[model samples]
Target: MTNDRRVIVHPDKPALASSVAARFLTKVVDLLDERPVVHIVLTGGSIANAVLEQVAQSSARDTIDWQRIHLWWGDERWVPLGDAERNEGQAHAALIDAIDIPEANVHAMPASDGGLTLDEAAEAYARELALHAPEGADTPVFDITFLGVGPDGHIASLFPHRSGIQVTDATVIPVRNSPKPPPERLSLTRPVLNASDRIWLVLAGADKASALGLALAGASRDEVPVAGIKGRRRTVFFVDREAAAEVPERLISPDY
Candidate 1:
């Protein structure tokens, strides 16, 4: 594992979500204390949704100024606005709607019903990022990004050996022929995701154990896209015991 990485294991899925939620809340509050606004990227999956639900139930959630918390999706299914498969939709139903977050601060990707082509939607999302990016940065320096690792080690829509993983110039790209269901999607490229100050990969279930192990063992990013993901300041993996089953002892933190 890389020197900047940390592995935190919880006894179960619920505990993993709760622990991550606590850390997430504290991180947001600390960032807001230093600035008026903080940008965050959200991911989708059972684990990610659970974390959002936990965040919604956090007692300290009131400490955050929801209006100053800008939300962005790390990747999104190219379906209609309210489709259950869409990450933004899941996030909204799980947490966003329960908070006082301003509508303008919620930057959801364009859906198929928006009358734009897949490439067009991807380009539009990239334009949105460029507009909100801090001065002199190609992409917004997200305060923290939450990602979920597929059982196959895919992160976002960047699946193993896929062309999407090779994209470096574009901030976001349209994904076609994805190995997973609902093949059509939009995802931020590696460079864009790696621009974040911190990254948290949330994983659970024994199905994810092997992939997580290979990723942390320094596998090729092209073969294991999640392996390439690292935050400028910190990269962390929050896994339940089931997911951590195959992780190397050296990568696992003794006290985390």
Candidate 2:
């Protein structure tokens, strides 16, 4: 099936979260219909986690074959296991904790607990993917990667002007001195993000207006790492009206 990148703008946070959660449910349902198992890469942050919370509240959550679904992280703060700031903890608090998905199927990036350095964690994640993903695939495995754009145009740990944007080999890498707090992180590189089957970038709030403007203006990927993402399957942007207001009004919605 040919997939088209879609842009949906909602009026409020609740509306945006519900809409995104519904779409996620639909996508997972479709994938499950096609195959027994679905592999998804999850993102962290208030907006992305809100989507998961909304999904948990939705009636459709029960329809998903949670057991057959596999989950991975797009990036993670390099903190000890169970750190409140950790993406794994955020996800668990929002949805995973409520769901019946097998613990073994949830592939969280390495935490500091395993005597693994950040680089070692990245390599370990790559090995895990190699073991689970199909042979000859573009990069390990991921049916979809959910991304959240920082106000400064960062995605995952590939912050603007960071060297992780240039990574080509390993799908995941350790990042140091990140612009945001908790300086250290592990992130999926641009090459890996570009290789994903689908990418859904969720943006909301008024603070993101300026960055959205720069991205739509055809900013260089190296300058705005979020803009660097190009997926082979499909790419989509889900933004609130406030966040997308700066985009050319004409491109805001084709239906308009």
Which stretches of candidate 2 lie above 4 Å from their native place?
1-5, 254-256
Instruction: List model 1 lDDT by residue over 154-243, tens digit each.
Output: 999999989898899899999999999898999999988888889999999999998999998999999989989999889999999999
Highest lDDT scorer: 1
Cα-based lDDT at residue 151, candidate 1 = 85
| Candidate 1 weakest lDDT stretch, 10 residues | 1-10
Best by TM-score: 1
Candidate 1, position 228, lDDT: 92
Candidate 1 segments whose C-alpha is farther than 4 A from its true place: none
Kindly report the root-mean-square deviation of model 1 from the true structure over all alpha carbons. 1.3
Residue-level lDDT of model 2, residues 24-54, one tens digit each, is: 9998999999987888889999989999999
In candidate 2, residue 230 scores what lDDT?
Answer: 64
Clash-forming residue pairs, model 1: none
What CA root-mean-square deviation does each model show from the true structure? 1.3, 2.0
Candidate 1 displacement at residue 176 in angstroms: 0.5
